[model samples]
Target: MLSKHFRWNKSRVELLGMIILSLFKIQNVQIPKIAEGIISDAKQDSVIKRIYRFFKDQLIDAVEVAALVVDILSLDKYLLVIDRTNWEFGKQSIISSDFI
Candidate 1:
């Protein structure tokens, strides 16, 4: 799916590899942690920055990718967990985050 959307070969491979690493590594979801688990290099910070840039660029449609993931997961029974958090800034109320 990513291969069809991501323009760069490096981006496609990195995205797929990181996803696979996340699935295997149950520790933390942070970029540095995930990069350490997958990459053999010592410079995890650089790898993390690269990953940040890849996502910051928004090379593909996030909504489409999310729908595709949900559809694929629906094939088998699974637990879907969502966590919501509310935040306040100054006198204004910021939108709550929806985490899965």
Candidate 2:
């Protein structure tokens, strides 16, 4: 699915697969935690560096990704809600929304 939208070599494609699996396994988006969940022969630090490099080097198009996801889901019809409200949480401002 990813390859269909992104022009990535074999190693890069495999790294993305590993990162995605790690995200599901660890339930976290933090690079360090995701690295910990990745099943790799390389050292944890190496995995972390690789992940960081991937994000830094990759030119991912959000529109293409969104199209790929919509294609994968095959949703016949759905409502998309985007909340523009700004809420303060401590020192950070967060805007959350849901799709139904």
RMSD (CA, angstroms), candidate 1 = 5.2
Poorly placed runs, candidate 2 (over 4 Å): 85-100
What TM-score quantifies how close candidate 1 is to the native fold?
0.51
List TM-score per model, in order. Answer: 0.51, 0.74
Q: 78, model 1: CA deviation in Å?
A: 11
> Which RMSD does model 2 reach against the true structure?
4.7
Question: After aligning candidate 1 to the native by TM-score, how far in Å is the CA of 68 from where it should be?
Answer: 2.2
User: Candidate 2 on 1-100: residue-level lDDT in tens?
Assistant: 7777667898888888888889999999999999999998999999999999999998878787777778789888867765667666996755534321
Superposed Cα deviation of residue 99, candidate 1 (Å)? 17
Give one digit per residue, the lDDT tens place, for model 1 in 72-93: 5665655666446566698666
lDDT of each: 0.64, 0.84
Q: Tell me how far the alpha carbon of residue 95 in candidate 1 is from the true structure, in angstroms, after superposition.
A: 4.4
**How close to the true structure is residue 93 of candidate 1, measured as C-alpha lDDT?**
64
